[model samples]
Target: MKKNSLILSVLLVGITACSTVTIKPEGQNKLVNKPTYQDSKPFYLWGLSGEHRVDVLKVCNKNEPLQMQSQQTFSDGVLALITLGIYAPHTVKVWCPKEES
Candidate 1:
């Protein structure tokens, strides 16, 4: 029905609007094609009480990351929405420099 369509449309818009991406530049011309590591960070109380810390050195095997990205993906947004903002999560990605030849 029209009501169902409207609800779906609103949800789609909300999920798309919630996505956010932040990239940190490390002065590298090229980065690895794939992420060195990817994981979801969990937070409680609408992200007010949990720590968002990623051990880049550990993740990159002691190498510096060429770039780092944190994003609120569609799945992340859905999880938060399901929890009614009580639980929030973010996806983090890191790209390491290519191994020296």
Candidate 2:
């Protein structure tokens, strides 16, 4: 039980520590709402190569997103751990600017 607890704690710390966030300069003061789009991006060979381009504008219907964030979630971390760093994935989230009233 103690060993399981230690592993769980370590995983939680790793997942949290790997989180990343980016806010566009133009959208700095924009009100942040729910994410407009979310997806998991796959990378191979320990993230050395893959389709890293995420079309935020296309996902946001040609409008640039106010913010974009990419991070390794618990599942992403688990998969990477299971694959021994061979296959890795990250969760991507985009927040689009609110429509003008």
Candidate 3:
């Protein structure tokens, strides 16, 4: 009984340890009351192996984000996996030229 309880506790800790969230463009802020969403490009998240913690900073570091795809997860005693779909790649680079502009 004690061993089972110990295992369950550990499992619970692992399951909810991470979560997924998405961000959108600044312009989209005016489109609706709630601007943010679980962003996706055109692909689907089938066979989800783990959690997908989202961050917009991901876009800036990489190119325009193939299929605008980004996700993260801790993969079973291994490295945290980051995956993105490459259906469509970015053509032009867009950046905030001015912080206010």
Q: Total clashing residue pairs per candidate?
A: 0, 0, 0
Q: For residue 98, what is the lDDT in candidate 1?
A: 65
- Error at 21, model 1, angstroms: 3.6
lDDT tens digits, residue span 1-101, model 1? 99999999998667544555546565655443778788999987656778878888888789977778777787787787788778888888888766777
lDDT agreement with native, every candidate: 0.76, 0.77, 0.34
C-alpha TM-scores of all predictions: 0.71, 0.69, 0.25
* Span of 10 residues, lowest total lDDT, candidate 2: 15-24
Worst 10 residues of 3 by lDDT: 88-97
Q: What TM-score would candidate 1 get against the native?
A: 0.71
Top-TM-score structure, candidate number: 1
Best by lDDT: 2
Those runs of model 2 whose alpha carbons end farther than 4 Å from true positions after fitting are 1-17, 26-32
- The digit string of per-residue lDDT tens for model 3 on 18-83 reads 333333455543222322233332322332333334443454453332222233333311122123
Residue pairs in collision within model 2: none
**Between the candidate structures 2 and 3, which one is better when assessed by lDDT?**
2
* Residue-pair clashes, model 1: 0
Q: How well does candidate 3 match the true structure in TM-score terms?
A: 0.25
Q: Return the candidate ranking by lDDT, descending.
A: 2, 1, 3
